[model samples]
Target chain A: MSHIIKPILYSYWRSSCSWRVRIALNLKEIPYDIKPVSLIKSGGEQHSNEFRDINPMEQVPAMHIDGVTLVESLSIMYYLEETRPQRPLLPPDFIKRAKVREICEVIASGIQPLQNLTVLIHVGEEKKNEWAKHWINRGFRAVEKLLSSSAGKYCVGDEITLADCCLIPQVFNARRFHVDLRPFPIILRIDRELENHPCFRSAHPSNQPDCPPEAIK
Target chain B: MSHIIKPILYSYWRSSCSWRVRIALNLKEIPYDIKPVSLIKSGGEQHSNEFRDINPMEQVPAMHIDGVTLVESLSIMYYLEETRPQRPLLPPDFIKRAKVREICEVIASGIQPLQNLTVLIHVGEEKKNEWAKHWINRGFRAVEKLLSSSAGKYCVGDEITLADCCLIPQVFNARRFHVDLRPFPIILRIDRELENHPCFRSAHPSNQPDCPPEAIK
Candidate 1:
């Protein structure tokens, strides 16, 4: 076995994608350092040439671990599951594992992308909030319906899988856009449950080192 | 061992996400049937209650395999990798597998979602093309840079991986939006090469049963 080193995550306090990774790392009891890349400082620091070299997509949370740099939040989460299989974020059954990933992709690809910083900036100020709410609500509707059949006190089941990591961060984003949570009671319930979970709490944006004082809730 | 049933893929010919799964099924040599879901017919058939039940997200490329239904192209792809294993779409090395998924997520989440049919409709006819071109360009710039270090005969290496399944369809969408391909030579070359490969050729939108006659290249 290769000697393991502490992972270093390149993240921003308010990025929901970064929060997903933080939750996963904490759940696995992995100790990792954070390098905050302010997305809004004098234009996005993610656009810097140096940061671009780390993740050509110029997104987070990227991580350096096991002698390699990895980018894309879902990819990083999967990598951790593969390398650090002790805490097991994915279910053992093939079908159940796919379902967990299905929820992750819905939020990661379907909902989150449309409301991300890059897309919102292009949406322009006048329509940004409306645009974010529209997509988030659309995605949450689907999630609520999926959870109707899939949930067992958490997104996929009673156990906290990677889906919970994905769900908590997305719910946090939905709240940021002031989306009506009543319509997604299942998601709201799951989020409420996860928010108090030690791993999720430790990884919350409010607790991140880079969170501005006023933004901490 | 339980007998495997031929999978049934719910797909829309021009849907890049659906096309990604189609390519994977083809590359895996898995004989599967296609159930067409028209994304543009009188609103979307995906919104119908029956279809929504299959995938509450109302997205195409949902597959019925191994006696259970699966949704989300990447999830379906991963499930296939776990079950089918033959004609693998992921590399054996953990880091290489993570890189392949990183490229897939970059295109799948970062680029495709921003320009999907649903988002384009909201973008409106006036700015839709410009909107698609902008996101596609930004994402292609990142994919192009990542390919500089990762490419051989395909997106990850000489043997095709899930990344190529994603890259080809996104390139197809890029062409549809009239984005110039000159700046992304590696992508263009890999695409040109893959377009002729039998698996990709079979899965091309033009050859699909639902492909409108006029849309065929």
Candidate 2:
């Protein structure tokens, strides 16, 4: 194989989607640089023509690798799993792989989008927290129930699969919104375990270069 | 191969995610039964203990196939692709496959979730259409831009990939919410082309057994 340039990830410090990709990169032990695109700075730099050229979606977690740009966190993870092929993020068994993707979709499609910054802005400041908590609680119920059946030490079985990558960030968002976590003991437990893991620890929002001083503990 | 029973899909007639799986099943030529779980009937049969037992997520497009159940449309599609592997939904080339998934995530995660029935319900009666249209338009712009580079006769290329399956249902939703398609000629064109394709036609919401009389043309 030809020598490939190190990937560059265009990410936002607090973006859950970006954080998922960050964890995947670390787990794969891929050397990459973060070119932070502040989502909150100057009313969102993602909307600029420059970033739009990189990802027409103007979304964070867009990655430039292997001479092409990739957008969407789950899609980027899939690319990494295929290209890197080390520290595999998805299980080999078809059913287990499907289960991993199932957990991912539950968070990627079902949970995160509804409570994202865009949606919250539209939800308005008056009812934002209530709206965020409502959706987060509804989604976490599904995640907890899913984890009950599939989880072991991580989200699916004892292996730290892509499901773990998706789960941790959303759990962070749930806490950020002040959604009660008591109902999701499995999720809470898995999150606690993952928080201590080096990959997850390094990828956390508070550790990102763009993380504000106030956000650090 | 061992003798396999036909899959049973727990789906709602007009649910876009369910429709995406329906199209994939048709494309694969897989014989299946639809056990319609009405989303609106009696406060949603999907929320019942019976349905919850099948899918803890309490969402439709759950499939009981190959002695295991699968939830999430994209996950089920991945299962179908891996297990069946007849008429392939994803391309063999890695980058092309990533592109297909990028489009899928654009709809599944970015667009469809924000405008889903649950979100609209929370957005409330008065502001529902406005909210739905707002999200659909934002997501559509991103999709249209992506399609500008990827689309040929279909979403990703000339072939009807998984991206097409995700695209058609979303275009239907965009129409449902009265999102202006004038700015998204590529998306509109692809939707028009796919609407008449046999696989897309048979799997359409209007063609579903559970479709109501008023929904039919």
- Residues B3-55 of candidate 1: C-alpha lDDT, one tens digit per residue: 36678999999999999999998998989999999998979998889898888
TM-score of each: 0.98, 0.98
Best by DockQ: 1
Give the top-scoring candidate (lDDT): 1
Global Cα lDDT for candidate 2: 0.90
Clashes of 2: 0
Q: Write the per-residue lDDT of candidate 1 for residues A1-217, one digit (tens) a residue.
A: 4436688999999899999999999999998999999999979999899999998888788999988888999999999999889899999988889989999999999999999998889899999999999999999998898888889989998899999999998988888899989988899889888778899998999999999999886
Q: What is the DockQ of candidate 2?
A: 0.85
Local distance difference test, per candidate?
0.92, 0.90
Please write out the lDDT profile of model 2 over residues B110-169, one tens digit for every residue.
Answer: 998888887777778999999889888888999999998888889888889999999999
The reply for model 1, stretches above 4 Å from the true place, is A1-3, B1-3
lDDT of 1: 0.92
TM-score of 2: 0.98
Candidate 2 docking: what grade?
high
